[model samples]
Target: MSGQLEVLNKKLKQAIDTRKVLETARKQQVDTLTNFAAKLSLSCKGMDIELDNRLAKFRSALSKGVDFENLAPLIAEILSLLKNQEAQQLSHQRELHTSVLTAGKLLQKTKGLPDDTRRMLRHLLDHQLNEIQSTNDFIPILNKLVSIYNQALNVKLSVKNTEDSITQPRLAKELLTLANDLVFEDEAADNVKAIKNKISETDSVEDLLTSAIEIIRIVATNISDERQSAQSFLVSLNQTLEDLHHSIVATSKHSESMSTEFETLNKRIESKIVNLTKQTQDATSISSLKALVDNELKSLSHDLIAKERLEQEDRQALIKNFHDINTRVGSLESKLSKYKKRLHEQRFKSLLDGLTKLPNRAAFDERFNHEFHLFSVQESDFTLVVIDVDHFKSINDQYGHSAGDKTLQVIAKALQMSIRKSDFIARYGGEEFVLLMPGMSVEHATAPLEKLRQAIKSIPFKFKNKSVQITVSVGATQFKKGDTPLIAFDRADDALYKAKKSGRDKLCINS
Candidate 1:
């Protein structure tokens, strides 16, 4: 009985050792989870406030050696928070992609953006946006935007005004009006009209400028077409004239040659007649006379045959000449008609203003150059004048542009009626007019310009059912020896500046 009790005690000791081992392993597993949760909580800090709070709570509970069963819900809560943040981030990145792409396109066209900077931007847009998935992909674009902003500020401070430097809002509006006046052909015309249609008072400057660039390209193409047509017409006309000249010389030579041929033929016929008469006189019998007459008739026929061939050749040559003349005349008539039509088109499209029906800047340039040439050669009296409507912007602002346009139209008519027939007037640009007064010195032109100013001031005008009085400032200058058109124009412009400065409704002259 004592031996059985000893064996039982050994078994009990073995079971106690096994329980202690399992308890130690369980404590180690809980310690490992708590240590891992501490690290995860640190990473989650500042990710989101709610995520940080939930992670902090989960980490605190984990430190208490919570079992996996009790910790599963907190782990699930952290996952949900992380997923919501990821979705919000994705939403933000999508919107950013659109804005960045659009901005890049516009910055590429900015006039003053440096080439190196532009190249970098282009590179970013081409390589980055194609498969962009996150905000990190736009890092290069973010860097470029800062650079572009700085460069734009530099350019704005230094950029001087030019034809393409249309910065003012009104300048764009004015340019649209002038752009519409240009006419092109076929697809080119439609392209220009399409671009013009896109223009509006409310469009951004970059959009409007982009449209302007496209319109300029279309206009340039039309000009090229016109040049090619004119060149072809000139070449054909020259060839036709040269051929007609050669034909005329050939006809003159042929007439003299024909006259000489006629004389030779007449002499040959007379000689034949003399020979026949002598032969007939020498006949001794009736039969011999008949044989001699037949022989003489055969010889005369041979001589007449050669003459007939020469006459036939002359008739064929004359027929060809007439045919050539008729064909050339028809060709010339057709070309002249086409040339006339082109010239009319050129005059209307290139030289006349669409709105006021007056001569435009190009016409002014042509006339000014021609008149200056005459002035230099003849040393005659020639004057140039510049006129500006007083308070024109005020009129437009208060009464609207339509009323302002009417005022300009009436003002243009009044100025036209006041000028002499020999004098020329043109719309220099917006709210400005230029005059070329031949046969008038600065002294003579001053009085007339003042009178014209007074006439413009007295013109009765109405806008928006209210009466408005219009006035003008005049500046005049006369051509002198060794003066170019540009010099004369500058003088008139300077005088105009003085007139406006002295006060409205004034006339100033530069000799």
Candidate 2:
């Protein structure tokens, strides 16, 4: 019996150890799986709706404590998405392979590329084909390369032409000019001005450092003051809302008081009338009855007179309160109107390109979303046209940023005039602009876009007494059924690439 007990104890210890080992392994796996899921989501969340939903569930389960039985199907789903993602990557890789090879070959043939430009190109091309992660990764690089190539071409052409380029002031002067325009608070403004003056006068490092420290401190204070000003606006608005609430509460309380008083008055009048009726009926003689009736009538008249006075007082109070409330409501409405106007102005500024005075990429996104949503419910389609200024960097290189800015503004105005009232145009970024044509197919859009192209080509651009011609390349695609925003954008972008490839200043419609 003792021997049997010892053997059972040993077996129990082994079982406990095995259970602990499993628990540790399970915890590690849960941690790892949760982390892996988040990593995957970073890359693939927007790729598919179903995959996103599945990832959410899997992550939720991991948080609760991972269950293999519940996770099995989810794991399968994630695996399926991974496979799909891999396949898409392979397709993108093939495209990258071709584009990169072409870029590399072009770089090899092209002469007079600057050291920095050459290095940038080599850095992009030296990556292994498999290391080409996504199509997005190479786009900006290609854009930069395109700009560089155009700059080189312009340089080569201008080698023979002896047109004197305009002398541009240093960027530092521009920064100082912009700084002077800023509304700085307290001593910061004075310090900044002093620094600007000192910069012009002395070369003492110690003096500069002391001034720099003082300026930094003052700037911090100024930023704080600016934040406080913004906060005060919110606080004032909140206080007004609170006042409105208090006014409503005061009205409700006044109403409740009046209701109680009215109820009391009704009960008192009713009780007195009942008592008088009984007393009159119980009178012993006519004289006694007359006296009793007169007394009761006088008493009731006194009560009515007192009540009338109270009611009149209440009515006057209520009127005053209503007038005050009306005034407050008017104030609130006026403030709200002012606030809305300010917000509108702020939003307009936020969505506008400062240089070109055109709606920026953020504005384009807003309009694109609206038009895309309209298509689904209203069965109305819109063509998304991407307009890229051809050899835009060349203009900047030959002239200056200020000249480029002026050129863009002129082009933007010209483009705006060319579009219909129903159509929308916005600066997409840099040298790219987008046009949205409502209830129009790409086929219908082509003619107007071509005219726009021609209009841009005809613009008389003269910088530093040298005539320079400017043109734009266009890409158009219709928003149709079974198209996501990403897919539609990709199609348009793809068309733009083709137009650029086929010697630019051309319009390609692929809808």
Candidate 3:
């Protein structure tokens, strides 16, 4: 029983020893795998950052978010495939090490073989050599291991040759070339076919390094090129914007200058109009005075002739006296007519507008009173329209006051054109105008007023070198029974005010 216990203790000791060896090997393998996985993880993470940066830059070119749903899965699949390949390589490396140990033991067993037996041993060794050479481990390490095995075999075979020594190095060189070609070909065969071909065909590790360096260089070059292109585009855009700004400024200046010219022209036209109206009034008054003077002269001549007949004895002396009185009366009559004509001419001239050849406010007032009384007495219906320019001050400020004046004149002309033969239109103030329509009610007046409004809106006024648009606010009212001219005018004025208040370039009618 003591001997049985001793055997059991020995078996337990052997089992403990075996477990220790297995634990050590497992620990080594675990450590290697951990280190390898850590390195690969770090490398893959770096690649991911680089790829993300590149993709971020690419995505920024689009206006919307990138659609990476399909692409994300593809990238994940690639990472999994790489992990599997790494695990297989590790397994193969362990297997290769075990095989090398086994081969070493076999060589040791054949150490004392005879020549014929040695040849057979050499064949077996060659087969093992082929197996080692075909491994997936690092080519240089695999080649070195195979060379060591060959050297050991050669020693046993008593074979010595300088030529054989060169063979392994040549094979190593070929294998290295093949490895490089395989990696490069795989990398180069991407979607960008031309770039792939260029990468594949390149020779030398330095060339590969240069190519890799060039990738970085190309990225830098692309960044620089993009910067330059962006700069150029910005410059061009700035130039275009600057040119547009200049054009707008020039156009604004031109409009202002034109407006000023038009205002001056309008003033001249108004002055001319005022003068012509005055002249016409003066001529009419002069004609009336001349008729009165002619009648007086005829009466005086007849009275003188009758007086001459009354004194027959002193007829010759009477006739001479009468003729003298008649001459003096005729001369006085002629002088009076001339003086009246001059006065009428002066009055007419005073009532005229120098710029527009139209009646001034004073002339309009005089005619309005006269016509108002006539219409009032006759019990005739008439409409009065007050037209005011809209945004006259703004037009002057933007285009210049000269343009404002031109706008007024253009509107005045349009009013004149729109009126009937019986209708009277006149400039009531600077930017205010008046139109009198006979036998028209406020409702009936709207058609003509709107027509006038549309006409003015349609007519383009050329002030200086610019064409300007203008509109008028009109207030119209019909004369009522027992209404004074002033009352009628006041109603029209209120309506005009309402039109301006509601909005400029619209019509308002006083009921």
TM accuracy, model 3:
0.36
In order of appearance, the predictions have TM-scores of 0.55, 0.55, 0.36
Model 1 clash pairs are none
The sequence of per-residue lDDT tens digits that candidate 3 reaches over residues 401-506 is 3455456656667777888888888777657788888877778888878988999888867666777778889999888888898999999999999999997889
Please identify model 2 stretches exceeding 4 Å from their true place. Answer: 1-230, 252-268, 376-381
lDDT of 2 by residue, 1-511 (tens): 9999999998999999998999999878868867886676756778778878888887777778766798898889889988987798778768777876786768656666677777766766676433656777667666766776786787666753423222112232333333333334356656676665554343344554565565567667866875886688788878877887887788779978987887888788888899999998999999998999898889889888878977997898788778878877888888779878866876786677655667777788898888888888886768999999998777765675556667778999999999999998888776788988998878878889999999999999999998989999999899879888889999999999999999999999887
Name the better of 2 and 3 by lDDT: 2
Residue 461 of candidate 2: its Cα lDDT? 92
- As for TM-score, the candidate ahead, 1 or 3, is 1
Per-residue lDDT, model 3, residue 497, is 96
lDDT of 3: 0.63
Tens-digit lDDT track for model 1 on 413-503?
A: 8889999999999988778999999999888877788888888888778776788888888888888887878888999999999999998
User: Candidate 2, which ten residues in sequence have the lowest lDDT sum?
Assistant: 163-172
Ranking by lDDT: 1, 2, 3
Error of 1 at 148 (Å): 19
